[model samples]
Target: MITRRLWLSAAAAVATTLIPGPAIAAEPLEVTAPTRVLGAIVAAEGGAAVVVRIDATLGPADLRVAGAVHSVAVSQRGLLDDPRNAPRVGAGVRKILSAVRPDLAATFEANHKAWTLTFVRKVLAWNARLAASPVRGKRIVDSFDRAALLAWAGAVVDPKGQPSPPALARAPKDAAASTLESYVAYVEALVRSLE
Candidate 1:
């Protein structure tokens, strides 16, 4: 009999072969909120516990920012934390963002500079709260609402109609982007759990 590992490797290879190269090659494999939603769909198609790691990786901040940007509000943290909700939230955000800002899908992939300061500010503000909180077991899905999450992501991706000011003399140009990239990576990993 084939070992589980072997079966998985073979299955992955087959799957990769089945998906057209142009589809995979057309874009970088970065994970966005929409992609996470896609991952959630994949996970749902696969089975439960398929998204637990994704759920666990998300903190309240992600949900709040994603939710806010998407204009949806989920009140209960526990409900958001449920693996069942992962796909729903993910799919919902994808649909909403696609309708509202079709450009984001491409911009997020190519232009790091295009991400607005407002979006960064919102994410930073929310992260500050999470950092300050002493709660150990509390999760992102457990705390933040969909409205909050969408608001944060929207702020990051586009700061139009928001105020602007001169850059801080003391702040390095790349500091914010560097920090955000790290945070994005962390969140992306959670989204990947769905895959």
Candidate 2:
């Protein structure tokens, strides 16, 4: 008969291999990246003439999304005056936005604050308008995963003002996935514009 220790060791090894690693746990969804790009585009446009306000009532849990948006806008604006530097600045903005997705999702999942949903939707609608504009239309098309990002944004917000912690945690992950795609696209556009 096999020794108990040996059997247990074999089982543990199998479990280690079979169970997903942290990388897998952290393996950003494909959609997460593009969402960042979308957010960046909004920031780039909004930062051009205005600072989009996150609903002031936001608490800790809702801050991830709000904070990411704010950071993206600031970063994008920093690139404005320097045409040669815009690409690098845009890349940096994308990185910051993409990196925050998981944390944002975790916070949303934990809090599921209702007001957050309204805030996200408002932002989404505004973004959609920008995406539709002629001057910036190409930028949005080239950079964003429009439908997925919109859906993800919708999922994070709670329309009824009821708080739901589990849902909030999931929000950031989706947003991050979308952001990643958007970032890649934005970088590409920035590079093209430089040429």
Candidate 3:
């Protein structure tokens, strides 16, 4: 029953009162405030923000899960925001990856606390690695359910390696996004909104 706009407005208000620092980077993110909500598109500067309307609004029908991956087109963003020519994916963005992600629903069923813990850890790490940069604002143009999201994240970040900023940036270009990245983006929005 929560509208996205209302949730974001509340999140931004809460983010400003807290002290900011790199120490928070290592802690697991909890869904304590509207800022911690999983999906929110925002534009922020320093510690103030405005929620954006550019990320796609996906219904169950828009999602297609096959080939062990869920992919959506860039035009979806246009439908959510500007429906002009629509941004096109570059040829270099195409990359086929194997090794499917973990079944997040199954994981949650088995142990909701563990799943939440991993999600919190990954998201906070994602914020530290990316959102902490000068760019300030990072919006989610696309999304998938929890299982699909973890699956996509596992695909982009190697099992034997950690995520690199440059590599994380490329995932979205290839019609994929990391859930942790997007959630942290919500936090960034809160910061911007508060300032």
Candidate 4:
């Protein structure tokens, strides 16, 4: 189990040699509303806690980012979508319904099982990309450069030296990349100084 610190250090050393700037040769990753919507939900409500389904037209979302608000078009299934699995599914649904919108239950029961397997898959994809990419950015280019560039610096200059950690934990940056299937690799690393 490579700890976050060690993993970051190893990658930082190799940052300079890695591809610079946008992978122009590589296809630009698609950043869509649905993806952002899923991220917004996760960033605010927590990922896969119950796979909360939100009304698509809720308008001006409260992502819990202290002043930043986004309106994402949630592509979600109804809470009652699976009666057989309601015990598991409803737990998540109830949490969201009580906290965000109690009315969702009626809407959910009306449209239960309208679709299936949307929320969990989206959450999984986000996790995969989150773990793979080292460069973190709000937009593809921004994070791609900052994360990778910073990693290179940490690896080459700092090495065993304690230094600032990468700006990898910002909610906006993480959410932005959450649903992207691409944006894999470009690992960057840095050490945390005990300051």
Largest lDDT belongs to which candidate?
A: 2
Give the number of colliding residue pairs in candidate 4: 5
- Evaluated against the true structure, the overall lDDT of model 3 is 0.28
Q: Which segments of candidate 4 are over 4 A away from where they belong?
A: 1-93, 96-104, 109-116, 130-164, 169-195
Candidate 4, position 83, lDDT = 20
Please identify which of the two predictions, 3 or 4, would achieve the higher lDDT against the true structure: 4
Q: Rank the candidates by lDDT, best first.
A: 2, 1, 4, 3
The lDDT of each candidate is 0.34, 0.35, 0.28, 0.32
Q: Using alpha carbons, what is the TM-score of model 2?
A: 0.22
Tell me the tens digit of each residue's lDDT in model 1 across 15-69: 9989777633232222222223333332222222122123335442242232342
TM-score of each: 0.22, 0.22, 0.21, 0.22
Give a tens-digit lDDT track for model 2, residues 1-195.
899999999999999999987753343322111233333333542232222233434321222333342333333322321223334434444454445554444332322233233334544454454344233312222122122232222322224433332322232222222232343344333223322
Error of 1 at 99 (Å): 2.0
lDDT of 3 by residue, 144-167 (tens): 212223222232323333333332
